[model samples]
Target: MPVREDKRGQERVWETRGSLPEPMLPLPFTVRKTRKETHDTYTLELQSESRPGGLAFAAGQFNMLYAFGVGEVPVSISGDPAAPEVLVHTVRAVGPVTRAISGVKPGDMLGVRGPFGTRWPLEDALGSDVVVVAGGIGLAPLRPALYQLFRRRRDYKRVALLYGARSPRDILYRRELGRWDKRPGVDVHVTVDHATEGWGGNEGVVTALIPKVEFDPAATVVMVCGPEIMMRFTVIEFQKRGVPSEKIYISMERNMQCGIGFCGHCQLGPYFVCKDGPVFRFGTIETFFGRREM
Candidate 1:
């Protein structure tokens, strides 16, 4: 049994002996395949031994991915959560944990905790225009949103995606990006900061793509993720378009030790990024935006 302190400061047993978090909704999944998207980016596809039962989630939620001994990290569920048996995660090899994840084989075991976090406002964007801006590996978190919109292509009016990478070789999800470009009612634009000889796309910051998007400021939802500097500039671009800050959502990245709220490593101002959000409407954090170190 585990004891917890209540608001009255009295200890209470929160669980009975030998009981564990409702049997942990375990699904036996195996890595179907792994694809290297970039030098450091990899996509892992996990398939259930059989079709999973009733696994569903909103567009922007994430999962805590566990690799045997390397520990766990909260990664956006890149696949359609509705098809829970076929889960996918796109990860960048930025640290030891990620490297370990990359080394996992087809038969390896991985644990998934949840489809956590408040999702992107998919329902609110119905019949409205949407602009998705991503930079570098930041695009991983937006994959689900893209899938949801495309899955129900008739629900929305127009959708545009603008993604920026550091170099031509750094682009992630090239295949899917190409597919999205060909889809009806969806426009996908890709750019790189430093172009190589073979590169023919736009060669500038992602903010440069903002002017090309067509949307009504009052009826649009802008979802952005990337490095802090990229997000700062993207928000400014949205402001220039007269979009309300409240209508723009941004995913914030931080060091989250415990996927749950127990550990405070992911705290930002009055909220915990791991709990209150990894995604937040710009206006909700507007006061503390760009002031973390100041």
Candidate 2:
């Protein structure tokens, strides 16, 4: 069986080719490869221990990664969902836990627990015009969704990507972004908040690029991620253009204490960002979304 069927006869779709013990436990995975993505950021590719083959995860879900002796942090899974042979995560080291994770070298062993949280609603987005808005590291979580769309191009109408970063040096997946921008039927517009020598991209926030892209706001499904403030403003822009709140989705980055909803650290009003979301339909959480300090 490609997946394990429980006593009740429900199929476990997330089982890797060979499968592992359980999804909730921190399964050991050896870092197989690493790539430097900017000065302070890197991406790690891991192979599961003893047949932890390709881990199945929806786009926008995260894994709680434990760097032996350092700490654990919730990081988005940033790989193609169709390929199930490797696990990937792109991280920007800003805190102690993340710093330790970025310091890991190939062949090092780490523990991972997840494929948690909701997805980007790629299924619902099919047959509709698609607008993807990302800021800085926010692009990491959206990478998989883009991969799926391109691989199955006939499933959607027009597609556009609007990305903004703090600076040219801060752009994540620069090489891939270039390639994607060149892909037929995909429109990519990237901007920067600030620039230095040799930089020639748009000099503004992400929302500015929104108005510049051509899409039927009434027919588009929007997916946005970044700092909470950026998402708030991006949503407002889409709303002004006639996109309904129900069609706008945003990924929430919170201080996740536990991958499960047991911990209250990621609480957002009545919902737990870790379990109930991390990705939420803007309409569902619209009232409390822009509230101060939430």
Candidate 1, 1-294: lDDT as tens digits: 234444422222223211113223434457878888999889998865554442355556666677776677778777775576577888888787788888778888776666555567676688888999999988988888888888877888779999999999999999889988998889899999999998989999999998887999988989998999999999998988899997898988878766566788877777667646677778887877788672
The C-alpha stretches of model 1 lying farther than 4 A from their native spots are 1-29, 48-51
Stretch of 10 with least lDDT, candidate 2: 9-18
| TM-score of every prediction relative to native | 0.87, 0.92
Per-residue lDDT of model 2, residues 232-276, tens digit only: 999999999999998999999888867677878998888788867
Global lDDT scores for all candidate models: 0.77, 0.85
Report residue 96 deviation for candidate 1 (angstroms): 0.7
Off by over 4 Å in 2: 1-24
